[model samples]
Target chain A: MAKFKKSALKENDGISAPETTSIAAISKIKEKRRQKKSTSDLVKAILNGNITALSQAITLVESKNSEHLEQANAIIKACLPHANKSVRIGITGVPGVGKSTFIESFGSYLTNIGKKVAVLAVDPSSSITKGSILGDKTRMEDLVKDKNAFIRPSPSGTSLGGVARKTRESIILCEAAGFDTIIIETVGVGQSETAVHSMVDFFLLLKLAGAGDELQGIKRGIIEMADAIAINKADGKNLKQAKLAKVEFNRALHLYPVKTSNWQPKVMTCSAIENEGIEAIYSMILEYKKLTIDNNYFYSKRNQQNKFWLIQTIEEQLKNDFFTNSKIKIELEQQLELIENNKTTPFVAAEYLLGLKT
Target chain B: MAKFKKSALKENDGISAPETTSIAAISKIKEKRRQKKSTSDLVKAILNGNITALSQAITLVESKNSEHLEQANAIIKACLPHANKSVRIGITGVPGVGKSTFIESFGSYLTNIGKKVAVLAVDPSSSITKGSILGDKTRMEDLVKDKNAFIRPSPSGTSLGGVARKTRESIILCEAAGFDTIIIETVGVGQSETAVHSMVDFFLLLKLAGAGDELQGIKRGIIEMADAIAINKADGKNLKQAKLAKVEFNRALHLYPVKTSNWQPKVMTCSAIENEGIEAIYSMILEYKKLTIDNNYFYSKRNQQNKFWLIQTIEEQLKNDFFTNSKIKIELEQQLELIENNKTTPFVAAEYLLGLKT
Candidate 1:
C-alpha cells in the first residue's frame, strides 16, 4: 500500500469505459484545425479571452507542421501583453502521491475562491508512451466539470524541450484567456520538473507521509527546486504520520541552503480528498507572493526565468542543429570511436567537428 | 577558531616574499618555447616521462595564439596513444576549509608512498582576478618541492569552458608523462566543479567541523556529486566536533536520492596537518575503484564521461558560434528587451533568432 493512491483512483470510476481517442490523437485533430484557422482570427479570439481559441493556439504551438511555426509565434506575440499577470505555479509528485487527486481538489478550491485556474501537465515521458494523459483526465473529473477551471493533459510526441516550450506558450494563452492561476503539473520522476520550475513563479512538491525515504521516492534536484512541499493524503489514519512527516520535512528543508528567493520553503500537511489544509496551502502561496512581491523578488525571479528559458531555448536549438546535422552525426561517431581508442582527445575531436561546420 | 586552519600552515613557513610573476605568465614564456619545439620532439619527451615537455605542451594547450592551436592539437594527438592509464581524482572545498593544506599533505603522502601525483587546480574565478595561482603554489610547499609530484596552478584569462578544455587536455599530457595519479582541484563555489566532476574518476569534497551550514558554502548539486566527503582539520580540540559533523553530513546526504553509481558516499573525519585518516580516505577510493571495476562500472562510467565531454564540448562550440555572431548578439538584446516588457514569449524570441540564423 503506497501512502497515496494515484492510478488507483482511475479504476474507481465504477464503469468500463468505451473506446476513446488518446490525447495524442486529440492533438492531431487540433493540429488539423489549427492549419484551417487564420492566425489573426485565432489570436483575436485568444486575446479576447476565448478558451477555445486559446486551446487551438496552444495546439498550434505543439504542432510539428512547418507552416504552424510562424502562426504560433504570431499568436504568442499577440498574447504576451495579456500574459504574465497570473501566479504561475508548478506542482509535482511521484506516482501514487495522489497528485491528480490533490490537483483536482486544489483546482476546484481555487475556482471556488473566485480564481480562474488552469491545470496543465508537462509529461515528456508520456511523449514516448502516449499514456498518462488519459489517466490524468479521468482522475480530474471534478475539476474537468468545473466551469472556472481548465484541465489540459500533457502534450505528447515531442522531446522534453519541445513539450516544455509548448506548455510555456500555453500558459501565456491561458493567462490571456483570463485564467489568473496556472498550475503546471509534472511527474516527479524526470527532467520535466526542471522545465516546469524554470517557467513557473512558484514550484510546489507533493509528498506522502511515513518519511518513506523521500530521497529515494523523489528525484534528486526536485526537492531543492521546490518552493513548498505539501504532504498530501493526510486524513483520518494518516494524519499523525502526516504531521510527523511535516517535522521531518522541516528538518530536511533546513539542511538546504537559503533559496535565492530569500523566502524559506514552507512545509505543510494536507488531505486533498477531505478538503483539509487546502485553504492553508492557497494562503501559503499568497503569503509567498506577498513576500516576493514586497521584496521585488517576484518580478525579478520572473524576469530571470524568462531570460533562462530564452537562453535554454537557444541552446536547445543550437544542440539540435549540430546533432541533427547529417555530416556531423557521422563525424561525431568517428570522433567518439577515436576517443574510446585513445587516438584523439575529446577537445581536439570537438574542434574538428566545429571546423567541419564551415 | 574555524574547524580548519589552511592559511596557518602558510604562515608557519615564515616567509613573506615579494610578488612574483604568476604561473600564467610562465605558461606564456613556455608557449613561446613550444613554438620552436617540433611536435614529435615534444611528444617524444612527454612519452618518455619528461615533465618539462609535458608542462610546455600544456602551456601550448592554454595558449590563445592561433598558431599554437595546430601544434597543441598535434601534440595531444601524438600523446593520446600513451595516455588514460592514470586514476583521475577531483577534490574541492570552500576557501577556508583547508583545501590547500589538505592537498599539500595528501599530495606529499601519495609521493611518500611511491605515487606520482599530478595536482592541478581548475579555477575559473581565478581567470577573472588573475590571483590564487601563486597563493596555491606557495601553500603547497611540500608537494611543490617533491620531485615525484607535479603541480600546476589554474590557467588565467580565459572562459571556464576554455580553461576546462586546457585542464582536461593537460590531464592527458600528464598521464602520458607517466604520472599515475591526477588530482583536479577547484574552488567549491562555481561551475568548475561540474567540469571537474565529469573528467575525474572520483570526486571528493572537503568539509569543516560543527556542520557550520555546509549548504551555505557549497553549491547544491555539488554535494550530490561527491563520492566522498572528508571533514578536514579533525584534530586536537576539533576532533569531537568533526565527529559530530561527520554524523551530520551522513544524515544530510541520506536525505537525497541515490546516485546512479550505486555507491554510498562516505563521510570521514581527517586531519591534514596531523596526517590522520589519509590512508582510510585513500583506501575508500581504492575500494570504490575495485567495486566499480569488478562490476564493470569503472570502464562504463569512463566511457559515459568521455561521451559527455565530447557532446558538451560540441554544444559549447555550437552556442559560441550562434551567440558570438554580431547579428545574433544584437538581435538577442532586442528580443530580451521585448521579453522583459512582456511583448513576446521566450520561445517566440528564440524562434526569431533561430529564423535569423537560417
Candidate 2:
C-alpha cells in the first residue's frame, strides 16, 4: 500500500541470484557432501585433524545402508595406524546423577589443560527413546561451544551391540583426528557399562551423597569394573555426607580381590557442578596412567580389549546370521513350544535346530 | 598253591564248564550290558525307576562318541515328559568348605524322609584334575551306601558347556527314574557356579566360618546369585565366628536389590560335621519353593532357563564350527596380528573374515 520505488518496477534488476537462502540448510548439504567423500580422502582428512571429516567418517561407520559398510571399513583401516594414542576414559552413573554436567565440567577441564577432548555416549536405550542421553547439545552448553572439544550423541541402533560397535569405531576416528582425551559416557542401567568398560582405559563412576540406600540402586558388577568412584555434589551441606560416602565406598571396594593391574581402585569426593575437586580427579588419573604404564598393564589391557572385541563381533554376527534365517526363525518358535510342553529337552531341541540350519 | 582244592582247577572232574574266572570282570561285563540298552528300552527302564538304567543313560549322555549323540538325544526326548517334577538344588563351595559332607548329610536327610535323591556334579576342572570333586564317591560314603540315594561323580569334559550339558541331560534321566530330589554339586572356583545356577531351582553357597575375610574369597557376582549362604563349621569355638559371619553376610545381602524371585536371600550358620542346621537348610529351600511356585516365578524361571540353554547350545556350536574352520583359523591369526599392529579395527577385521567364510 506504500509508495513503490520506480527503479524496482523497471525490472532491469537482473534476478539478483535468489537471495542466498537458509544458511543452516546449506551447511547441512555441505555436511552431506563431506560425508560422501571417498574412503581414502576421508581417512586422509581425518589424519590431518579435520573434525568435519572425522564426524563424516563416524556417520559412515554408523550407517545401516549396506553400501556404506565397505567405505566405513576402509576409513577405519586407514585410520587405525593413527589411533590408540588417546586416553580413553569411560564415565557412567544412573539417570538423575548429572552425567551431562559432569562430562561438561570434566571435559572443559581437560581442554583447559591443553588436551583435545572428544565426548561420545553409548546409550542402548537411545534407539527406543530416540536418544534420551547426550542427544541434545543444549545439555552441555559450554562444551558444545568449546572449539577444542567434540560432542556426539549416542548412535541409534536396534541392539546395544550395533551401537557399541559404532562408538568404538568412532573412537578410532576421533583419535586419528588428534583427540588426545576421549570420554565415553553410558547410563549405568544395563549391559552398556560392560561394553564401555571393555573399550576404555579407565572407568569412573559418579554417585550422589545421601541418596538413601547408598548401594541399593547400583547394578551388579559395576563397582568391580570401576577404576575410581567419585561422590559428586560434594559441596554445601552435602560435603560431610559425601566424605562419609567416600569412606564407605573405599571400604566396600577393598572387599574385592586385588586387580591384576596391581593398582588399587580409589574413591574420592567431587563437585562437578561447582567444578571443585576436578583437578584432583585428573591428577589421580594421571597417577593411575603412570603406574599402569610403568607396570605394563595399560598396553596389556588394550591388547586384551582388542581381542575381546574381535571375538565379540564375530560371535554377534554369527548369532545374527543364525537367528535371522527365515526357516530357523519359524522353527525356533515351534521348538520353544515343544519346550513348554515338555515334549523335548533343550539340548535335543538345539541339536534339531542346528541340523535344520545345515 | 599245592594246597588248592581239586575242583578249582579240574578240567574234567565233573565236566564243569570252565569254572567262571574273575567274578569282578564278569560283573563288569554285565554292567556294560546294562549301559548299552536300546533307546526305547532305556527310556522304559528309567521310567520304571531303575537306578541302573538311569546311570547307564547318564553315561550315554556323557560319552564323546558321535555315535552316541543320536541315542542320547532320543533318551532325553523320551525322558522329557517325566522331567521337571523334582526340586533341583545346586550346592557350591571352595575345596575345604565341606561341600561333600554337607551333601552327604543333607542328601541322607532327604532320602530318610522317603524322598528319592540323585546327586550329580559339574566340575569342568574334573577333566584336567581327574575330578578332584565327586570323582571319588568315597567322599560321600554313607550317602553312597543309601539304597534310596544315587550319587554320580562329576562328568568330565574339556569345556564347561559340554560338562554342563551332560549334567543337565542326566537330570532328566534321574527325574524319570523317580528321583524326587536332585542335588547338583560344583567346585565354587570357576564358571561352574553360573552354569549350576542356571539349571537349579535353588542355589546354596557353602562357606567356612571365620575365613578372615568373609567375602574376599568369593568370586565376583557369586554372592548376588546365591539363594542362601550357609556358614559351615559353626560347631565348637567356630560357632561364634560363624554367627558373626552370618550377620555380616546378611547385611551385605540386604545391600543388593531385591531379587526377581520376590524372596529375600537368607544367610545362616550351620555345621556339616555335626549334622546341625541341616534340617533348617531344607526348610529354607522348601519355603523358597513354595513362594516361587505360589508367585508363578518357579515355572517362568524354568521356561527362561530352557530357552537359555537352547540358545547357548546353538551359539556354542556356532563358535565351535567357526573357530574350527581351517581357513578361519589361519585368517584369525593374521587378523590378530593386524590388531596387534593397529592396522585394522576389530570390527573391520571381523567383517573381512566373515566375508571370507561366505
Off by over 4 Å in 2: A1-36, A127-129, A211-213, B1-36, B211-213
Candidate 2 lDDT over A52-94, as tens digits, reads: 9888888888888888877888888888888899899999998
Q: Estimate, for each residue in B106-181, the C-alpha lDDT of model 1 and write its tens digit.
A: 8888899999999887887785446654344788888888989998888874688777888888998999899999
Inter-residue clash pairs, candidate 1? none
Candidate 2 per-residue C-alpha lDDT over B1-358 given as tens digits, one digit per residue, 9 for 90 to 100? 8667657656645665665688888899999977666899989999999988888788888888877877888888888889899999999988888999899889888888899999999888886456658867787899999999999988878899988999998998899899989999999647889999999999999998766767776887888889999999899999989998999899889888899999999998888878899999999999999999999999999999999999999999999999899999999999999899998888878888999887
Q: What's the TM-score of every candidate structure?
A: 0.85, 0.89
Candidate models: Cα lDDT each: 0.85, 0.89
